[model samples]
Target: MAIPPDIKDSIAKVKPLSQSAVRLMSIMADPDHTVAQIAAVVESDPILTGNVLRVVNSPAFGLRAKISTVARAVSYTGGNMVVGLALHLCASGIFNNPLDGYESQRGSLWRHCLFTAIASREIARFSDGKADPEVAYTAGLLHDIGKAVMSAPLGDSARKIIAIADKGEMPDFVAGEAKAVGTDHPEVGEAIAIHWSLPGPLREVIRHHHAPSKAKEEYRTLVYAVHLGDFIAMMSGTGTGADTMLYLLDHDYRNFVDISAAELEKVILDAGQEYQQVVESMFGSEEEMQ
Candidate 1:
């Protein structure tokens, strides 16, 4: 679908997806790249190298790695881990702050998105291996691309539209967004995903995360995973904003993914254990919040 003009203009103002992140994703997607090649890319960029070192020696690793070189970092965690950290560092720019019109403070949207990403990866792990955890992580990270697209145009008016939706006056939250901004976030986000050359399934996750049942058959499980991740983030109070009331739990997911509430609870707790560590490693320390 063509992007709504107002939302497109807003997307225009927002920072484009990082080219370095895009290149890293492309290289990672291909298995032909050797560890040396990946390390060389990180070594050439000081900022990227610093991010790699941070994750390598983070609390998540359970010890002070004290690693000093990009190649050694790559050796410690393998090429795949390096790619993941590089992706995290590169993708942080567009998502590193709270989106105006979508939240009251900076980093709120990013916090919510990170929560969803973490939950999505964990969900994929316990879904009988039906989902790809790596892809799930990427999808969760970018699921709210639409809100970012609307940031500039919607500005502070998100609350007004959200109020209208919360009052049960619209078909759903997306409808409320359409009424206020001339377009909805899901569709706008889908456009951005396609323009970014994301895989078809990832695009579906971005577009149908709020309504997983509407997704195509092949991508339904991935969609459901993101939907649950989104719900978990909302329930956990990560950064729901006005969406707290607008979205509902997707009950139909049980038929596809086999997870009990007890298990789900455990998942959240486990994710919580590493949440701060993961966030600080990817985005930076609490200094980012200030």
Candidate 2:
């Protein structure tokens, strides 16, 4: 679907990710970027380096030993995980705002995004071969970027959409956004990703997460992972928005990831534990981030 010019303009006004995040993302985009290169970029910023070590030692990675150095963290968790940790830390400022349109309190969306990203990583790890953990993490982290854009400058419009959504007039947040703005957040997010020249698969996941079957076949697995992760985050009450329980869980999610109900239960349980630690790694505590 083509993005409306109005939505494109709205997305343009949404702030770009921080330069440090962009640099880490650029390095991660290169398949050949070495762990040393990733560690070097992360180490350039003391905060990012600390966050990387925090994440590596956190229960999120299930590491038996604490990592004290960026190089060691990268070696322990892979370059992609290290880069993702850096991006999350550097980009926290951007996600810390309240999403008025989505009814997300200050830092709520950030918590949701963090949980979803971690859930996506776990889903990929258990996919048996359908997805990449690192790629899934990035996709899940950014799947709702357009929602932020839509919520930033379109508060009144979003209120109207949300009212309609509350009445069951729309299928989900994406549908309500399209009804109010002539384009949904996913489309606007796709445009924003294109504007930023983000990787193609990342753009696809952001665009088609609401409809993974409609995405390019190459990215369908990744999209499915993010979609399920998003659902899991909402269901787990991981600091989500008013749209919580508004979206439908794909009944056939098992077809994509081959995870049983029992396994998925474990994922949600583990994600809740990691979510607290991940949030602490980036923002200290819920009170502080807010």
Candidate 3:
């Protein structure tokens, strides 16, 4: 289906991922890049550096000594983690708005993304998959970026799609979205990711998090990680939106990862508490009262 002209125009105006973020991902992709080189690139952007430090020092990592510098953070979290956190920090502002049809509040979507990211790391740890926990985390954080893109101008259409899905018991929200808006958020998100030249795996995860069975082998694990993480967060009521429970678990997802319903419950319970603490630390005294 062709993208509607209005939606296409809005999407055309949306900014690509920041250059600093692109540079960081490039450095991460290069095996020869050293810690100092990565640090140098990150340090060039003061805002990005500050946000990265905030995340590393937040309750999530729980480091003993306060990390005050980019190099120290890179040393502590490793290059991949540093890059992941950088991407997270850079993209945090993108999903801070409410999608028209979704119940995600201002910043609520971001919180959901954050929770999914944290849960993804836990899933990775348990499955012992080749997936980098940090990469999984970043993928989880960005899985819903397309919703943000679609909602900017197509908010009304998106809202109608969600309403139909909710009222008619549609099997898939994406189908409802396609019926209402000519495209699903995942496809739109993939387009946006492609425009930004995101890492291939990260792009695949964003495109396929909602449908992990369709992803390539290497990407399927990460996709499932984010998918499971999203479900766990929604079920736990961590930072869920309107469409939180609109989707069902893919049967194939069960075969890709070793997580059980019991284990998932435990992760959600634990991550919920950690999520609140992290949000409190990140926002300082303004943590959403739930």
TM-score of 1: 0.84
Error of 1 at 31 (Å): 9.9
C-alpha lDDT of residue 105 in model 1: 59
lDDT of 2 by residue, 183-239 (tens): 777887788788767888889989988788888987788888998998889888774
Question: Which sections of candidate 3 miss by over 4 Å?
Answer: 26-38, 53-67, 74-89, 153-169, 285-290
Which lDDT tens digits does candidate 1 get at residues 1-290? 45667666655555555555666556654536667877887888788788788777776565554888888877765554455455446555455555766664566666777788878878877667667666677678778877766666666776776667667776566776767677778888888777777778779999999889999988888789888988787777786465554776679888667889899998888766656766665545645642
How far off is residue 217 in model 1, in Å? 1.3
Error of 1 at 168 (Å): 2.5
lDDT of 3 by residue, 162-260 (tens): 667767767777777777678777888877777777889878988888888889987787788888888878777754455667787887766767878
List the pairs of residues colliding in candidate 1.
Answer: 98-107, 101-155
Candidate 2: which stretches are off by over 4 Å? 1-6, 14-20, 26-34, 45-47, 50-68, 73-81, 89-93, 157-163
lDDT of 2: 0.75
Candidate number with the higher lDDT (2 or 3): 2
TM-score of 2: 0.84
